[model samples]
Target: MTWQTGLSGFLAGLLISIVTAPVGVSGAVFLLPVQLSVLHVPNPAVTPTNLLFNVVAGPGALARYRRNGQLTGPLARLLITGTVPGVVLGAIIRVFAIPGPQVFRLVAAAVLLPLGLWLCARALRPAAGDRPPLTRRTILGLGLATGTVGGVYGIGGGSILGPILAGRGTPMTHIAPAALASTFLTSIVGAATYAVLALTTDGDIAPHWILGLLCGIGGLIGGYLGARLQPRLPEKALRLLLGSLATALAALYLFQGLNPSGGN
Candidate 1:
């Protein structure tokens, strides 16, 4: 990659993570657009590249959360349990089954649009206080579904999971670190899966290492700063922020899905 492209990747990761890390996302969901459009990274490979970014970038915000004693919890554990395997499966599917960009975009839009709207609606409602914790089965199911999507889309699944949890009344403090942790770990697995697939298969399946690392360097800094900022933001504001981001991404994907030529 050119220096200009590397710099652009860094800036994109930095800015996207600064906003998304506060909501437990590693910002790969946003970075996917940058990779596909501005950076002109090829498909399939871009998925692993995004996962690489999550793997490298996740530790920054996680470290901050750990310092504040918000890093580990039951929610985090359950999510990791389900997402790890699911992401591996998803990577396989991405490489072998559904390699087209249009299908993945449609799937992402279908999932995110309704959930984003629900989270926004919930945020606008009066506080009902903390609801009962989600059942282990429910959390595990969510992890599996979202992780599969993440593998296909190159996200850590936090962009999807965080909103759902928030809409169910989980506190931001609890959601942020947990979702990030899961994203980090799952991305590691997802990236590795893609690497292995690259050995056995053809086409652009492996990540662009230099580009991924450049973006990750920026993400690492941005994530740490965003985590530091998260504590000061009100819960409702965080929800709205996450909701708005999801909705916007969903719209973009929906358009791309409908008009394949435009996305290319």
Candidate 2:
């Protein structure tokens, strides 16, 4: 890659890491478009490459979360059990049914639109810090839905899981660590699944390892710093920011879906 492009990738990774890492995401949401548009590498490979980035970047954040005693193995297990199969289903759907960005974005936007509105509305209400814990059924459903979307979109379902739970007024103190652990494990499974597919199938999909690694390196540092900052950050302020960001991203993708001529 050119120096200019390399710089862009690193900076993008850093920025996304700071924005999302604090909330337990691995920066894949922002990186997907960069891969699709900037690198002009649009295919099934995009998702896994982002997953690869997660693999490289996740450990640093996970370490921080674990050190802080935020991560729980049981929670990770619960999330993964539901997410793994769901992601496999999503991968299959991407391969067979919704390969095009236009259709996929439309579907994604439709789902995110409601969630975004709910997040916004929730942001306006009084904070519910002592909300009831999520039921097993609820966790299962979240994992399935999140895994499927993560599989199709690339990255872990934490982007969906994090904000949705937060909107429900789950404490970020708990949500942050759990989401990070969940995303870390989810990315591992997703990456392995994609690697297997690459081996069995023709040369249709494979990660751009070099690029993914560079992004991951940047994300590692950013993620560490974000995690350190998260506890100090005000809960209400963070939720409002996330709610606004989610709605805006949904709207952008929805607009892009309408204007199919716009590449990536």
Candidate 3:
């Protein structure tokens, strides 16, 4: 890659980290599109590359949550336990059940559209005073489902899980931190699964060593900044921005599905 490409990736990573920090997303929604559209990365490689970014970027945010005592240990453990298995399965599916790029785009649209709308609705709704206690079963179930999606899409999966937890009355304070921790753990699993698949199926599918290093450098800086600034942002405005961006990305993927000739 040229210096220009490196600079662009670095800046993009920084900006995404800043925007998504408040919302508890790792910013794969933003990064994936940029990788495809601007970097001209191929579809098959995009998920893995994004996963690489997540792997590099997730730990610092998780560490921040841990330091602040925001993360719920039981909830995080349950989420990781369920999601790890699902991530492995999803990676297998990515290799053997490899859908056409158009089909994958369509599926991505389906998953992200509803998630985006839900975020928007939650933002508009009034917050209740009391939140229900987090449970093992529910967290595990949600983790399993979201992990599969994240594994396939190469995102943190918190993009889906975060809103659900909030809607279910998890406090934003706890939800954001726990979700970030969960995303970090699950991302490690997903990245490993993808790495295994990439090695067996297509050695070139994910150039892990190079991409991982670059993404890590960017993610580390961004994650640290994002975690530091999380408390100051207005929740409603943050949700609106995140939801809007997710919706837009879903629409862009949907359009790409429809117009294969135009290219992503």
Q: Which one wins on TM-score?
A: 1
The true-versus-predicted C-alpha distance at residue 231 of model 2, in Å, is 1.6
Q: After superposition, how far is residue 256 of candidate 2 from its true place, in Å?
A: 2.0
lDDT of 2 by residue, 1-264 (tens): 677766677777777787677776558876876777787555767778888888887777777877888886566677777777877777666666776778767765765666566656766887556567778789889889988888777767766677667665566777777777777777777787877777877644677777878888888887887888887876556556656766777787788889998646
Angstrom error at residue 179, model 3: 1.6
* lDDT of model 2, residue 73: 52
Best by lDDT: 1
Q: Candidate 1 has what TM-score?
A: 0.94
lDDT of 1 by residue, 12-81 (tens): 9898888888878668877887898899999878899999999889999999999999976788998888
Residue-wise lDDT of candidate 3 within 61-109, one digit each (tens)? 7677667777755656666777777776766676667657887788788
Question: Candidate 2: minimum summed lDDT over ten consecutive residues — where?
Answer: 234-243
lDDT score of model 1? 0.85
Query: Candidate 1 vs candidate 3: which has greater lDDT?
Result: 1
**What overall lDDT, based on C-alpha atoms, would model 3 receive against the true structure?**
0.74
Extract clashing residue pairs from model 1.
Answer: none
Deviation in Å, model 2, residue 46 alpha carbon: 1.9
Q: Which candidate model has the greater TM-score, 1 or 2? A: 1
Error of 3 at 71 (Å): 2.8
TM-scores, each model vs. reference? 0.94, 0.89, 0.91
- Residue 262 CA error for candidate 2 (Å)? 2.9
Candidate 2 residue 97 C-alpha distance from true site, Å: 1.7
